[model samples]
Target: MMMIELLKPDYIFESSWEVCNKVGGIYTVLSTRAKTLQDAFPDKIFFIGPDVWSGKENPLFSEDENCLKDWCAYARESDGLKIRVGRWNIPGSPITILVDFTPFYAQKNDIYGQAWCDFQVDSLHAYGDYDEASMFAYAAGKVVESFYRHCLSKKDRVVYHANEWMTGLGALYLRKHVPEIATIFTTHATSIGRSIAGNNKPLYDYLFAYNGDQMAGELNMQSKHSIEKQTAHHVDCFTTVSEITNNECRELLDKSADVVLMNGFEDDFVPKGNTFVARRKKARQAMLNLANKLLGTKLTDETLIVGTSGRYEFKNKGINVYLESLNRLTRDKNLKRDVLAFINVPGWVGDPREDLIARLKSKEQFTTPLEVPFITHWLHNMNHDQVLDMLKYLNMSNAPESKVKVIFVPCYLDGNDGIWNMHYYDLILGYDLSVYPSYYEPWGYTPLESIAFHVPTVTTDLAGFGLWVNSLKGRFSELADGVKVIHRTDYNYSEVADVIKDTVSDFSALSAAEIKKIRKNAAAIAEKALWKHFIQYYYEAYDIALRNAEKRLAL
Candidate 1:
């Protein structure tokens, strides 16, 4: 085996779905990874993304008025795209560029515009049809092409790393024009999986229906499967967030990625010791209060507080599966433990069908005035007219148990809702067990973050981290009892409920000595899986790309 030296590229361009504008795990990866990239290859790494408009003027770009104008003009005239270039001065390193192509983004009907919008919408809070998204993607593609052209002439060996299908277009564009340039494509999650999980559609119908040519022409109509296929086929070297996504690429796109680079955590930010304990205690107390108000019974310390938190879509994030498990657990007569599930799923109340169903079932509910108001308010906001229809529909099915108090915290919480929401750390520390059964997770950071916080996690095999965990099962099994990996495919509602019941029961069975040991082991595992260790992989990936490019040059 050859130990490759850290030969830094003359210039490195990283285009991610989220850079300054963060909507998901990619944002955290880009933001935290920047420092490491800079430290390893100072003044060489450049990050490019759409210049999302901010209410306040950016000081970074404001300082470089003339250079920014010159770059913009050059990009427009030479590259044939409207581009805004902003620079961020990284301490002890090269400047990071924030690429703004809002003008191109505004032209949603175009090919590049649609692509940009599709990527940004995944991170943006608001939701709309695909016209805006299609235009966004098209504009993004144009802007990326312009940026690549602008940076290509610079005297360093150019290394381009594009994240997800959204930015993969840039690498594809480069490959067509400059085949010698080192291009690496990273698929966070496969489009096929995401679409099937998100859109309640059959896999075959979604995957085979739309091809790249067809998708490039139509904005929102093309399936995610097509976008992923295009990404894999075009990039020079392909990388995925986890083994799961790698497998997905092989299965769906029939193209295997070169590497599996798992996502990682920043340890310094995670709350621990007194801080973590205090927050957990506060969350427990809040849950107890909510339970008392709902079931009219004070929750005891012995009560197992099973927590599940994520963005509020029931189908994709596995909220429906979670609810079914909870329903099954409540029906278990043999189960001895008093279990209470605290659901921190945001955007649930906004869903019409689910909200209507919840409201209808509440009529026979035993919840108190305080609890009722909160639940009803959430329901009303979600769908006012449909709620009445839901009440009528629930007359047929059994009412949800009052014991399993499902408290809906509809808004985004920061340190106030059971735990601090400092991106990853705060959210992970809030629960004893974090449930993430995502149907389409490119690379889940929640499981890793949960383990880091000494909080146990249960994630589906569909997730990237879950696949990684399964690979390290022997190591994980030895580390702690805190984390539990469940194969969602193996179990239905009842089986999942049994597993949840057993896990909670086993957690209760643990002695104080046992719990302390589990926490220590979890911390150890987290240290080994930190972002610092993962940063090395990025350099290695670049090395691979460069070596291949060099070989091509020699030939």
Candidate 2:
């Protein structure tokens, strides 16, 4: 085999819908890895995002009116571009530009027409946020092209990386307008794959039999799928977050990934020694106090605080499986110790439960259980919610008679959920164990975040993180290794639930020293996943992208 020479870019521009916006898992991927990229390139890296917070305060962004002063003025005059330059409030504090794409909506048709003419991207069947996301993407590409023309020399090597299908238009636009600039398009998850899974179809079992274009049309994903497939085929490099997602790209996008860019995390968000202990203690106390007040029964420290949290995807995130497992745990007559399962998934909550708030404020234990004690907050439609319906179906009333109690925290834990009044990390540190039984996770971050905080977690083999754990041990992972890789299949929902119940029962029965050892091991696993260790893969990706760009330019 001939040896491959490594190449690097002089400048890198990464555009995503989540750059300054914290939407989903992609935000975690970019924010946590920003510091590592900044250390290597200094001020050479720039992040492009949509300017949603035009006149409002964006806590994640620290705007600087003078950071890109001359370029901003020149671009506005020459290209009609609207932008705000700032530093993202992440570890790396990388330079970020939030583009105002509102003005471009009027010209969406012309832009979509050009995209179809140049790259064969089919936006004719677009609906909902498809037009909005494409406008942002097109605006981002324009921003990069204008900046390159005004600031950089033609001889300089540059790379433009767009993340997810939402930004596929940007990558395609960059490749068309500035053919000299290399481009990398990463699909964290394919549109058709997600649609298939979300609609209760078996994505994995029937993956090989499905045609990308045919499925796109049948599933009403034509517009997003067309752009993603075209960008993947046209870009200098195509990448995905994991081996599992790469397979999805091959089967659904008709393209094999140039690289599998595993997501990495920074440990700077975790608190240090004494602070960590203090926060954990405080979190546990608050959790127990609220449980006591809501259920009218005092829960001791020894009660196993189990949790499952993510987007409210009833099936995709395995919320149904998790609840079913909890339902089983609640009725297990042999289970001796108490287990408090918290569903921290945010929903359409209206306000905090006033009765629970009043009870907590009075510093008095309630003699009677509050009405509808299962949820911490008041939801917009409590009667019609799916989670509530499931709980009702399981008859989990969190009464004084049950050995296991389940609580629903239906609001984001951003230090103002009105109950915990703590950040998610602070609140999650209180959990003795976390469970993430995902059905369609491209790269699981919640489980990784749990282990990072020294909380042993349960995840299924279907998740990328769970597969990584299995790779380390070459067998089923157990609680002793800081994780339990439960064997899950498309049809093994009940089996997975049984496994989770058994795992939690076994964990609750462990001795103090054994639990401490497991916690230590969990932290060690997180150490292996830090950005410092995983940054090397990014370097590998950058090299592949640059070398491919060189070959294209040569032709």
Candidate 3:
């Protein structure tokens, strides 16, 4: 078949569950990339998402009745869609539609029936988030349909992009109803692939052996996987964030992406020069003060603060591997500096420790460890918490004599967690290193954000970002190269842990000049991953979708 001519989009309608909501890595991907797209297309790009806040204020959304007043009115009076027109309070402040899908829940069965008929989507085994997300997506589709019919013409070159399995229903809805509009579907991570890895199964080693439909049945993921699989097949263009996920899509979804839209980020949030130095100094002081009071250990300002943070996925996010590596580092005799490793993953946090709070406020110093000095916040299920359990299993007591100490922060650093009253970005600047030895990461924003903050990190070959770094460097990447990409597999847990231990220990021994150079190198790598560079892949997707849409319309 002859390749279709590439086309530029006059307007773009992108939808994701995380558009204005700060959910997972998708928020970072969308928010950071928004500026680039906005600059390129001016006021032609719009984002659509679910408004789950239910009347309470969301800091991320700045509502403006004037932004899309006409469409908002038409959507309500004509199409009966409940939506709030606003600008997402990010860098570009892109125009957005926050749909209230509450009313759509009443017609859930009808919507599901239509989906089954139109796209052969199987919602028979639907449960949990399947209904809720589908309703939101279905409402979004109506919102877009109303807008396209109200404002756009058939001659307009437009692209309707939906993200993740959560928005698959919307993409399929558009394909069936508005075939004139080009459509793109991006699966950030395959539902079945995530289920396979989350269940502690070997995904990569046995990827070919595992049948997606069979595994979906066995794992009770028929609904989510079905929508994802069908949407990937039905959309004009199917894309993923990275090569790792593209491979997963081919094997699990049985369709390779037309293009791999590698998640890129900007550094407008990062401070520079003397301001950065001062902020880092202040951040380090705050962390040290908290540690000194909570653990009753006289940790100096010179302590190497290394941390890892994300959703509390013990194995998937490699929290287990990270903790095991920290345990090994504590025993390494070659370590020349005090390393303060922080497990920053949030859990079922109950509240901040009252005694720790008192100590943070007081100038009075103490030499005795507080009760459960290892964790900053109290978990709802203290005895059953996985991080605490892992600490106990590893015999990590955070003893004052040990050169390496671990602190588990089981709360989101959203400026008011009682302790560490700063945003994650503000506080994380003080860290010397970040590690994400993920067992299964489609495209890790943790390490990307880490390096963007100029903190060199150790990640695994399994992560999409790690593989990208390897491609940039060619040789085996090391901490000196701004990233250390450790080779990891289902069975190489011990080797990955040992490599992390040795790398961190060696890092602690690096001279000040060498460390500064490594930090510079890391930031340079981040520059290469900016949206200015990665936005081309998105254009490629738009081209494919537009060309395919034309062919379908002709057919």
Q: What's model 2's lDDT at 482?
A: 98
The best candidate in terms of lDDT: 3
- Model-by-model lDDT, in order? 0.58, 0.90, 0.92
TM-score winner, 1 or 3: 3
RMSD of each: 7.0, 1.2, 1.5
Q: Would you estimate the TM-scores of all the predictions?
A: 0.76, 0.98, 0.98
**Cand. 3 Cα-lDDT:** 0.92
For model 3, give the 10-residue run with minimal summed lDDT: 65-74
Candidate 1 Cα outliers beyond 4 Å, as residue runs: 1-7, 56-96, 105-155, 178-180, 198-224, 286-297, 300-302, 333-337, 348-403, 414-428, 475-480, 490-493, 551-555
RMSD of 2: 1.2
For candidate 1, write residues 444-545 as lDDT tens digits: 776677778777777766676776666666543422545566665522545655665656556656766886787776676667777788876776777778
Ranking by lDDT: 3, 2, 1
| lDDT digits (tens) for residues 132-203 of candidate 3 | 999989998888889989998999988999999999899888888888899999999999999999999999
Which one wins by TM-score: 1 or 2?
2
> Which parts of model 2 are misplaced by more than 4 Å?
1-5
TM-score of 3: 0.98
